[model samples]
Target: MRVHIILAAVFWCGFVDSRKIRGISSSYKRFYRERKSFLCIDGSKILPFEQVNDDYCDCEDGSDEPGTSACPRGRFYCTNLGFRPHYIPSSRVNDGICDCCDASDEYNSHAHCQNTCWNLGQRERAYVEGQMRTLDEGLRLKQQLIEEGVLLWREKQAQLRELQQVAEDLQIKLEEHRRRKNEADRLKEQTLKALEAGDSGLIRQNSTVTSVFQLLDSNKDGSITVDELQARVALIHDEERVLSEDEAVALLGGGHQMELTKFRHTLWDILTKGDSVKIKDTLGAPDSLGGEDPHLKAADRAAKWEATNLKKVEEAYDTVNMEISDLQKKLTIDYGTDWEFLFLNNQCYKLKVYEYTYTLCPFNQVTQKNTAGTEVSLGHFFCIVCQTLTRRTVCVLGGCGP
Candidate 1:
C-alpha cells in the first residue's frame, strides 16, 4: 500500500509539470473558446494555444505564440549555452553562429551563447573610408582649379589696364596732329592771299586788251568785216564813204590787208603797251564815261578770284580724300583684312563680313545612295582679301525626285 501511494504521487507531479510546460491554463481555454484559428509553425495548423507550446511545431509561419520556443524552423531562444547571448539579423537565425555551433541557440533552456558579428561591421567601415578618400581627392583638385582661375582673372585685369592707357595716349596724339594741321592751313591761306594781290595790276591790263579785241570783233565772226569797219568809222565821223567797184575790189585783195593789220596793231599797242599809260587814261576819263571800265574790271576780277578759289577748294578736297583713304587702310590693317568701314549713327563703324557657301543637291534616292549618301555638298572658303564667297555647281541630269 505505501509503494502504490508513492508511485501515484510521483505520477501526479509529472502530470502537473507537463501541463505547465505546455502553457495550458483556464485563460488559454477561454481565449480560444468556439474559435476556429490555426497556429503557423512547420507549415501545419493546430487547434489551440495548449498545443502551441507542446514542444511541437504546429504553425506554417510560426506566428502563434511568438513569445514561446516550441516551434522548429521558427524563432528560438538561447540562454547562452557556452557564451554570451546576442540578437542577430533574422536571416542569421539558423545560420549556425560560431559561438552556437552546437545548435544550442534553438533551445529555450540553454544558457551558453557566443557572438562573432565583427566581420560584416569591419567591411562596412572599410567601404565608407574608401568613399571618403575619393571625395577628398576630388575636393583637392577642385580647389586647385579655383586657384588657377583666380590667377588668370588677375592677369586679364592687368592687360585691360594697359590697353586703356594706350588708348588714352593715342587720343592725345591725334588731337595734337589736328591742331598743327589747322595752324598750317591758316598760314597757307595768308600766303595765297598775298600772291593773289600781287597779280591784280597785270590782270587789269590784260582784261582791258581782251575787251578791246572783243569790241573790234563785234559780230563774233572771228574777223573784221566791212560792216564792222563802217560802224566804227561812223561812230568817229558823221560822213559816210561810198566805195566804188574798183576800190571795193582793191580792198578785198591782199594788197590792202597789210595796212589794215598795221592799223589794228597800232591801236592795240596804244592801249596795252604800259600799265602807267593805261592807268593815266583811266584816271583822266570822265567819271560817267569811264563807269563801264570799273564794272568790267570788277567782273574780270571776280572771275579770276573764283578760278583761284576753285583751285584751292579742289586741292583741299583732294587732300581730305587722300587722308580719309589712308585712315581707312590703316584701320583695316589694325582690325582685320576683312573688316569694312560702314557709316552708321553719323560715325564710322568697323564690321566683319563672313562669307561661306553650301550646296544643296536635289537627286533621287538611288542617286543619293550612289553619291555617297549625301544630300548636300559644302565647298566652303573664306576670302580675307575681298571678304567674298564664290560657289560653282553642276546640276545632275534628271535626278530630282518628287
Candidate 2:
C-alpha cells in the first residue's frame, strides 16, 4: 500500500550527476520501461533508488555512497576545474586537510573549508616560477666558479710541473758538480803522488790552474795583489767572503807569483768540489741527495717555488670538490626529487638583521656574523632543522632569490 509505494520509489532512483547510473555501463538512451527501477552497482541486487547523496550506504561495494563518508572504500572525485580533477578516499573527504582545491571533498564537513583553490593555484604558480628562476641564476654562478676552479687547478699543476722540472734540472746540475769534484780530487791526489815519485811530467796537476791565476793578476804582476785577490774571492763561495787586503795577500804565503800552490789551498775546495751544498738547501732538505750554489741559487729558488705551488694547487682542488658536494646535497633537500633545484646548489642565502648578518650556503653550512668581525656557525646544511629553517626564512634572499 503506502509503504510499498515508498519502497518502489527508492529502487527506481537513477544516476544523476557524477555517479554511474544503475552502477553499470549500458546504453540507456530512453527508459522505455518503468523509469523508477534501479540496479545495484555490481548487478548483485535491485532496488528502487532516489537521491543517493543522503549520507547513507545502499550498496555493498559502496558505489551508492559517492560524496558522503558512509563508506570507507568509497572514492570521491574532485572537479578541480581551475587546476585538474583528482580523486581521494571517502574517509579523507571531510578530514579538514584541504586535499581538494574545489572544496568538494569537504561538502559535509563541520569546519568550513573555503574554495580558495584559485588563489592557491596562483600562489603555487608564482612560487614555482620564482624558485626556478633563482635556481637557474644560482646554478649559473656556481658553474662559473666550478669552471674557474678547474682552470686554476690545471694551471697550478702545469706551473708545478714546470717548477718541478726546474728543481730536477738543478738536482742534475748538483750531481754533475759532485762528480766533477770527485774527479778533481782524484786527479789532485794522483798528481801529488806522482810528484813524490819523481814524475816531472805531472808537476802541476792541471795547467788550467796556472792560467787562471795569471788572469787574476790584473796588474800584469806575476803575483796576485791584495786588491786583485779580494775583489774576485766573493764569486768563489755560495755566500760572499769579503777578505781584507792583508788577508788576501797572506794567501800568497810570501810568494811573488800567484802560484798554483797558493791558489789550491784557499777557496780551491769549492772551486773544485762545485758549491753544491748551498744548492741542496733551497729544496727544503727533502733529502741529503742520499748523502748531500750555482747556478746553485737559481736552482734553489726554482725548487722552493715548485713546492709552494704544489701545495696551493692541492688545496684548491680539494676545496672545489667539497663545495660541489655540499651544493648537490642542498639542492636535493630544498626541492625534493627535482633536478631543477640543482641550480641552487652551492648558492648562498643571506639575511641582515638589526645588528647581525646571517648566511646560509646551500649544502655547505649556515653561519651568522656580526659587523664586528665575530662569526658563529649555526649548523651544517645537511641537518634537517637547519635546512628547514633556511628554507622557511626569507629575511634577505641572496643569490638563491629570484
Candidate 3:
C-alpha cells in the first residue's frame, strides 16, 4: 500500500510538470483541456477527449488529430524552445524523416533527428547582423554621394549661366563687326566709281600715277615715246597679239610721243574705263601697269580685313551658342530627384566580353569595339529606367548614337 501511494505521487508530479498536449504550441494549449468532451478548433463537432492524437481523424477540419498523421490537412508544431518555434504538416510526422529540429516529428519512426536549432539560430543571427552592418554602411556612402552630386549640379548650372552671358556678349560683338564690314564695303565701291569717272585732279596729284608715267618713260626724258611704250610689256592688244605702234600712239592722244601731263589726261581714262584696254599683270611684272588705282586697292584691302573680322566674330558667336544649347539640354536631364547621378554626366565605363569591348558614356553614347579595333556605335543614352542611369533601350542615328 505504501509503494502504491509513492507511485501515485510520482505520476501526479510528472502530470503536473508536463501538462502536455502533443503537436500544439504553448499558445494553443488552453483549447485542449482534460474535460470529458473536446471541441474541434473550427467548432465542427465535439468528441471524447481521448480521441485527440489517437491516430484517427474525426474532425473534418483535422483539428482533433493535430499530433497524428491520420488527417491529411493536419499540422504539427515543434516547440523549439531554445531556438525558434514553428509548425510542420501532419504528413511529415513519423514518416521515417525528421522534419523538426527537436526530433519530435520522427518520434515513432526509426530516423534520428538532432536538435541543431540552437546552433543554426546562432549562425543565422550572425549573418543577419553582418547584413545589417553592410546595409548601414551602404546607406551612409549613398548619402555622401548625394551631397557631392548636388554640389556638382550647382557648379554645372553656374557654368551654364556664365556661358550664356558670354554668348550674349559674342552676339553683340558679331553684330557690330557685321556693321563695320558693310560700311567698309560701301565706301570701297564709291571710291572705285569716282576714280573710274576721270577725276583727273586726284590722278595728277597721285604718287601712283606719277610712278606709272616714270615707268613708261624708259629714256627718263619726262615724255613717253611710242618706242618707249612699245619697249614696255605693260600693254596687251588682245590674247594673241602685243600692242602695235598705232595703238600706243592712240593711247597717248594721237601723238608719236606725249609728255607726262597729256599722258595722264588721256591714258588714265583709257586704262581705267574701257574693256578694250587690258593690263596683263602687276606693276613690277612684265605687264607693269596691270592693276587699278592704288587708293582703290587700299580701300578694297580694308574692306576685306573688316569682312574677315566679321567672320571671326560670327564663328565665335556660333560656338558660344552651341555651348549654351548643350548646357541647356544637360540641365533639363533628370539626373535624379537629388541629382545623385550628376557625377556620372561625362563619365565612361568599359566592359569586355569575348572579342568585343563595350563602352558606356553616361548621358552620351554606347559603343562596341571588336578585337580588330573596329568600333561601331551601339546606341546613345536614352532616358534612365529602373534606377540605372547607364542602361538604355534605344539608339539614335547621329553624332551621339548609331
Candidate 4:
C-alpha cells in the first residue's frame, strides 16, 4: 500500500507502493484513536473508515479526507522529520505545490514530487549539530574566563591588603628612627659647645662624640667615604645596627664624603646613644611599599612617605576596579539575549558565498560583507524567539542550508 501524507494528514491510496511514512508526532497521534470498520474524524459521525481520502468530503470539520482536496478548510501536516514540520491548507493537496518534504501532497500527480526528505533531513541535522558545537565551545571558554576573573580579583585583593599593611609598618619605623636621630644630634651639639668652651676635664674622659669622630678619621683627611667608613663599620652597627651606603652618604650632606661636622652628627648618635634606633631607607625603592625620600630633610620624610604611598595605592586600586568592570562586561556578553543564545551574545555569525559574506550579530546589527571590498549594514538584530526570522526567513540556494 502506498501512503500519502499532506501537511498534518495521512491517507492510503492502496495503488502505488513506495517509501514508508515516518511515525506521527504526539500532537497528531490523537486522530488515530477509536478505529473500527467505520470511524468518524471526531468519532461523532460514523462512515466506513475506507471512505477516508476517497476524493470527497464527509465530516463537517473536513477531517476525513485529510490527504486530499476534498474539503477546502481542512489542514495537511508535513512531517519534515529531522527538521520542523509545517501545516498547509488541505486545498493545496495534489495542487502541484511541494508543500511537504516527502512530496506526499503531490502523491498522485503525474509530476510526482521526488523524495528529498531524507537528504534535506540529514543536511539540516548536521547544520544544527555543528551550530550547537560552536555554541558549546564558546560557552566553555566564557565560563573558564569568568572563573579566572574571579580568581584574579581575589588575588589582587590579597595583594593590596598586604601592600597596605607593609606600607603602614614602614611608616611607623621610619618615624621612630627619625626622632632618635634628632635626639642624638642635640646631644652632640651640646657636647661640642662644652669642648669649645675648654672643658678639658670632659675631653680627657674620652667620652665625647668628637673623640669617636677622630677615631673614624683613619686617613686624617678629617672626613669619611664608604672606603673610610668600612673600617668603623662595626661601630656603625653598634649605633644604628645597620646602614646602607646611600644612607651613610646622605647623612654626610649628600656627597661621597662626610666632613668632621657630618661625622660628629651621626657619630654622637651612635656612640652616646647605644639604644638609639638606626635609620633605614624603608620608604624609597623603585617600587617600595613605603619609605623616606633620602634627598629630603628628615622632617619632610614623613610627608613624602604619605604622599607617595597614597599615589601608588590609588593607582593600584583603580587598576583592580577596571579589571572588575571588564569582567562584568564579559559576563554580560556571555549570556546575551537568552541563556541558549549567550554564546551568540556579542558574537557574530557569518556566511560566505561567492559574492559576499552575510553576518548576524545577536542584539546588535546585521551586515553584508562584500568579498571584494566594503561591508554594508543590512539591519538591526534582536531577540524574537528572541525575535525569530526577524524581517524575513533568510535563505540561500544550492546544497547548503541554514
Find the candidate with the highest TM-score and give its number: 3
Backbone Cα, N, C clashes tallied per candidate: 16, 13, 0, 13
Q: Which residue pairs in model 3 clash with each other?
A: none
Per-residue C-alpha lDDT of model 3 across residues 218-275, encoded as one tens digit per residue = 4557798878666553444444456688888787789888886776687755655534
lDDT of 4 by residue, 237-338 (tens): 354344567755654567878766665565444533433322333332211112322112222333334444445555655655566555454444333222
Candidate 1 residues lying further than 4 Å off, grouped into runs, are 1-117, 189-402
Off by over 4 Å in 3: 1-5, 13-19, 25-43, 46-50, 79-85, 106-112, 198-298, 381-402
Across 1-402, the per-residue lDDT of candidate 2 in tens digits comes to: 999988777765532333433211123223212346556457665655553545677777666566677777777777765565667777776777777777777755686777777886788788889999999999897677666655544554565565555555655545554453444444445545665687755543344354344334444345666666554444323334465556555555554336556666753444435433111233233112112112223223333343444455555555555555544343234432223344455689999998899998765678999999799998665553433655643232222321
The alpha-carbon deviation from the true structure for residue 130 of candidate 1, after best TM-score superposition, in angstroms, is 2.8
Best by lDDT: 3
Between candidates 1 and 2, name the one with more favorable TM-score: 2
**TM-score, cand. 1 vs. native:** 0.24
Per-candidate RMSD, Å: 27.7, 15.2, 14.2, 15.2
lDDT of 1 at 32: 34
lDDT of each: 0.40, 0.53, 0.72, 0.55
List the candidate 2 regions with Cα displacement exceeding 4 Å.
Answer: 1-64, 83-89, 92-99, 106-114, 191-203, 207-402
Tens digits of per-residue lDDT, candidate 1, 228-319, equal 43333221121234333344323334332223344345534533333211221222231221333432432333333334444554555555
